[model samples]
Target: MSRPRLLPWSNVDGNPCYLLGDGTGSSYLSRVADNVESVQLDMAEELLNHAADLLCDSDSDSKTTSPQLRFLAARLTEALRDVHRIACSRGARLALPDGDDDDDDDDERTDD
Candidate 1:
């Protein structure tokens, strides 16, 4: 008999997970292993905290950010703009969801 590997899940409400993967199989373990890349995950967490702290509007009792946070916010703004350009170049278009009454009458007219 072999010992089962360990897996840490996100929630107390979530079901227990047992991940088993073959070298090339598209299994849950493979995906989780791929997603849990250490360096990239650390960078992502840094970026998330950076954006959340700097970009979010301040509430009544909040304090100002340090010099580092100011620099992070500027960098995050630039990165977001670059992402927007790439999304636009990839033909990403935002449209109202099906049967949405959100658009104006003139906006709804199309050549048919």
Candidate 2:
């Protein structure tokens, strides 16, 4: 089989997902990947905030630990891993395939 043009994201089972495209990161799968990545980033931010709150709690000292804190830590780790994978997949999608050099640039086109 041939290589896929678009590398969107992995499934919940951690399987690879592929899409046929022209190497431009503008396909429907790519858009979905973008949206999912945005959500994951938002989630990561929220998780960070939650972790901070846990750390700032008066009962949470260096000598003690809580079940909630442990659970949140585990969840946060998992979420971060997911976000990292998605980021890698998005990066792969942005990469130009073998001989395709057409610049579908996102840089601003200024009128001089």
Candidate 3:
């Protein structure tokens, strides 16, 4: 697999870290086929399948020299996309612990 094999898009509310140094210089994206996260497990295959397609087809003009690389890339792209959709789609405001904050608060805080 090429570098950055494909990772579930991760959103960090805190400082982010990477496991640099896997022969490819960058960290290879890893995920268990059977994840404990029900959400990931539920959509893993579909997401990877879509990502695999995306990896190959992201650029219409770029001729894919390797089918294996294309498949891996597509699965990664799709997995990241799915992870993004799952982890990021909150309609703007992520309800506070009390679940009682105005939606505008989200925008205002982010703008600051």
Candidate 4:
């Protein structure tokens, strides 16, 4: 029997789950991963917004001792770690800003 492709998420037993797919961006498993990543990112954004609101409040430092604040921070940290792993596994790259230069030419081209 062919070995199943391992998914990004784990099963109930903390074992890696497998799916049938070619691993390309258009594959079924890949699509599922993409959707999951999107939701994870959305959750992260919301969490950050909430945290920001809390921090911006005048009584934020006093409120930080609350259980709810701690829970939110813990959840956000877990989500961050998960998203980082997913990004690494998917080989996602961030485009770096161009250096301070007047020439705005593409790097791929060279003057021969």
Candidate 5:
């Protein structure tokens, strides 16, 4: 049996979703996930740009307000979550090196 793909989005109950396929990316759901991931990454880039602009504004008469900072923090947190999910899903789908599949603990080691 082929390995399941970690879907980009979770279920309505906040659980991670998976797709069992023949390891091909031609499925409709796979294409949709790919598109969603692309949009998510693009949005993250745009958010970072906006954050830089908001943080670099040095006008004394128009200081960054506490509410503005709070809102920015919330948006940043959401973006980070989405990016992290995408990274995990993609990472799980990556092909392992030869003879490297048995060393799952290698990734958990703190020392490089």
Candidate 6:
């Protein structure tokens, strides 16, 4: 048995979810997770763009209202949480070199 994969979303109670697998990433749930993560990342990108637009507008005479800014902040927070979860899940699944369990070197490298 292999280490269980951390899922991108939590349970109804807000606890992290996991998927037990045999190491091969061909399971149905794996595909679903992949799709979901993709969607989440895309949404996050869109939200970031919207936030930039809102802030830019606020700099001009078309000032953004307090309620609109509040709503945007809330959505940005949710998007950030999803993106963080995806990063954690993917980072955990990365394969390290054999006989090298320490990830100190990884700190110097950035994923493209």
lDDT of 6 by residue, 16-60 (tens): 999998888899999999999999999999999988888876474
How much is 82 displaced in model 4, in angstroms? 1.9
Q: Which ten residues in a row have the lowest lDDT in candidate 3?
A: 27-36
Q: Candidate 5 — worst ten consecutive residues by lDDT sum?
A: 56-65
Give all TM-scores, in the order shown.
0.30, 0.61, 0.30, 0.61, 0.84, 0.83
What is candidate 3's local distance difference test score?
Answer: 0.47
Q: By summed lDDT, which 10 consecutive residues of candidate 2 come out lowest?
A: 1-10
Question: How good is model 2 by TM-score?
Answer: 0.61
Q: Tell me model 5's lDDT, rounded to 2 decimals.
A: 0.88
lDDT of 3 at 54: 53
Q: What overall lDDT goes with each candidate model? A: 0.50, 0.69, 0.47, 0.70, 0.88, 0.88
Candidate 4 Cα lDDT to native: 0.70
Write one digit per residue (lDDT tens) for candidate 2, span 45-104: 889887887778677666446877789879898788877776676565464678665554
Instruction: Estimate the Cα RMSD of every predicted model relative to the unseen true structure.
Output: 15.3, 9.0, 15.7, 8.9, 4.5, 6.7
Candidate 3 per-residue C-alpha lDDT over 1-112 given as tens digits, one digit per residue, 9 for 90 to 100: 2222223334486332222234332323323311323456466776666555655576843755578566666766766666654454322224357656458667556542
Model 4 compared with the native: what TM-score?
A: 0.61
Which candidate do you rate higher for TM-score, 4 or 6?
6
Collision count for each candidate, in order: 0, 0, 8, 0, 0, 0
Model 3 clashes, total count: 8
Model 5 C-alpha lDDT per residue in residues 1-112, reported as the tens digit of each score: 5678888788999999998887888899999989999999999999999998898867732888889999999999989999999999888888887878677798778964
Model 6 misplaced regions, further than 4 Å? 58-62, 102-112
2 against 6, candidate with superior lDDT: 6
TM-score of 1: 0.30
- Model 6, position 80, has a per-residue lDDT of 93
